[model samples]
Target: MRYVISFIWAFMLTQMVNFVLNSLGGGSPYMFWSGVALAVIITATIAIFDVMLKHPDEENEAQHNH
Candidate 1:
């Protein structure tokens, strides 16, 4: 559920940036690549933060179980 929300948030953010760039006369290829890059960056940042906020005990337990 968190990941799903993150993805949707990233998509919306990318679209907003793409819209602004397009209005400024950016090319289609530039718009597409920029949007993709933004989405990747946003998703990765959210995932990293989520992991950082997770409990250390839970992480250790999961690792030990595996």
Candidate 2:
């Protein structure tokens, strides 16, 4: 269920950016590449933030500090 929601959210965001690019002065290639770049950045950012939140490394590091 969570994965489904994430996928929908990502799709909506990507499409919104793509639409805006097309509306602006960008060509088809620019729109396509920008949309791809946006998707990759958003996905990576969410994944990294989720990981850090779920497992804070400072706690693990302190445990090993002994």
Candidate 3:
């Protein structure tokens, strides 16, 4: 659920960034922005997933921790 929401937010943000860049005059619209957009997405996913994984399951996972 968290990841799903994070992904949705990422997609929206990337598109919003792309749209804003497109509105700003000059350069290929989708050229560099596509990579920029993907970087934003991957960065967001990593950040969000890191937060989600911060707390270990004390009872189950801790028992198995090596």
**Predictions: Cα RMSD each:** 3.9, 6.2, 5.1
What is the clash count of model 1?
Answer: 0
Candidate 2 C-alpha lDDT tens digits along 1-66 = 664466568767897878876778555554565666667677777777877787667778978997
lDDT per residue, candidate 3, 1-66, as tens digits?
A: 766676667667777777677778564545555745685677676887786787756546767875
Question: Model 1, residue 55: displacement in angstroms?
Answer: 3.7
* Residue range with the least summed lDDT across 10 consecutive positions in model 1: 26-35
> Which pairs of residues collide in model 3?
none
**How big is the RMSD of model 2?**
6.2
lDDT score, candidate 2: 0.70
Tens-digit lDDT track for model 1 on 1-66? 888788788988898879877878855454566777788788989999988899999999999999
Candidate closer to the true structure by lDDT (higher is better), 1 or 3: 1
Candidate 2, after superposition: displacement of residue 31 in Å? 1.4
- lDDT of candidates 1 onward, in order: 0.82, 0.70, 0.68
